[model samples]
Target: MSSSNKPHYEADPNKVDYDEGNNRWTFKPRGLSIIWGNDRRYWNLPDQSSFAVDRTLNYDMDYDQRSEALSGPHWKGDGSSISSDKACPATCRVPAKALNIIWGNDPRFWQWIKLSEVETRSVGFDEGARLLQVNWIEVTGKLPTTMFNVASTTKYEVYYVMKFQVDAFGWHSVPIKFKVRLNGQETAKNFVLESYKEKHDVWHEICGGEFTVSKNAAGVVEFGMFEVKSEWWKGSVVLAGWSEDDVSQSQQTREETSYSQPRHIEETSTEAKLGETKLKRVEKEAESKAPSGSTRESSRF
Candidate 1:
């Protein structure tokens, strides 16, 4: 039978009956198949209660669709990329445009580094390597958590993957070391990238093991890369994950609305308290103005 036409049974947890012959549990609806035995078992039937989230940071200018051409070789000072001290002159040549030049000094070019407190520089381009030189780019900050929706008393796992490349841009033959930390904890041992080798443009992958996110708390993912001692490092970084209890987009909106309900209730409660206080004050005034206790009682009657 087609999945849509298949018979579905809603089993009562407390009333499930065990069948000795089949070594399975039978439910209310006849012909419902629910296997529970040494040979076969089914637990936690699908209810579409989970949510998945995958987010990636775009650093390469080639794929940017903005008419302003926001992505490309850019530079910045003081760790802020919003303003540029200088920008590469615009070119109409197809070959020059394809170069996708990016200066490490221009903050506008580096969109991936959200927070930095150190001075950094971007150097030459490797035509064969397709890599741009970057030095002393110390970055540390929390990844976006607005997309997370976790529930209390439930544990959720966050898996992350970051891909990039590092090299010592021919200036030195010494190896270059790169550090990456997630959620304030070191994810992997620091590794060295050999300088000026044939494989200097070698790619690297950082696989962050599943980290548990506490209930009702947004997952915090932080990326940190230390200064490259000799050569420039270039590549893209990507982070993505999903939760066991996935929240649909509409459900997330509802959750946000629910968060506002308490404040609304507080406002309504304040108005009610004010009304009560006014009523009490008016009652006191009326009592004082009444001719006497018996006269007030007679008027009321």
Candidate 2:
């Protein structure tokens, strides 16, 4: 037999598409990267670029289109969007002060203000244009000097700060201002508040805004009112923020990681709850006063 008549052999790996889905570009054997060509059109695709010409010619697809050809069965094509859960509703309460409400849900906790109907159009209400309305009371209670020691102690003032948070998937919130009233007297200036969050839970905090009661006022501090402006989507709810001078660094790191989760902030007490403290008379302070004429340093807890 002549040497030219003998069979021919190629020393290269062949490209095989076993799945027919355009994806699954596996070499003939599992680990082989160098694909050999036996008089085939092209050789050594190196990275994706080398295969670009062949992929375009064989499939008549552009680079982008060819790249996506095989992305179906095994992978949900690139750039796919993921849907998220709706935002949960938030509630605020003050354990010591109880406002006039239909029910006292918890006997141990005194809720001074409640703003559930912040939503517009609750059945037969007027128009849905009302920003969240606040219900406040001028209940008598001593300030937690130990817990919030950063606040002024010389002559305590009733500053009303407002903070709020909203739940929205893709919607951006607009800035808004609200009203603060003390004993039926509304302030000329509105309190400004901002939003913040940890993990999935969001909160708003309004600080340094207070109403003052004169030493000659009848009782301790009276119920002063504070309102906030907020935009709500069909799926989101707003919550309150804390009055902390410095936010924890650990909280910021958690936001970037996918493992972030919600955390609860508990009220701390240095001493046991005093039985006599419940009825203790509130001394009238002379110097402290809020822009609003009413007396009482209030916040959304």
lDDT of 2 by residue, 1-301 (tens): 1122323323233344444676545443212332332211222222323432223223565544443453211111111111121111111122221221111121111122343454211111111111122222111222222222222222222322222324322122222222334455543322212123232332222232234333334322232222212212211223221112222232463364332232211111111122112212111221132223433323431
- After superposing candidate 1 on the true structure, give the runs of residues whose Cα lies further than 4 Å from its correct spot: 1-131, 139-141, 144-146, 150-188, 195-204, 208-211, 228-301
| Candidate 1 C-alpha lDDT tens digits along 1-301 | 1132333333335344566875765442222344431111112232222210111122332332331243223322222311232211210001111211234323222323321122111111111112223433333323323223334332222212122334333323222222233355544222222221333322222221223344445545443333333223433331111111221232353254311111111234444355345434544555676444322111100
lDDT, model 1: 0.28
Best by TM-score: 1
Query: What are the lDDT figures for the candidates, one per model?
Result: 0.28, 0.25
TM-score for each of the candidates: 0.26, 0.23
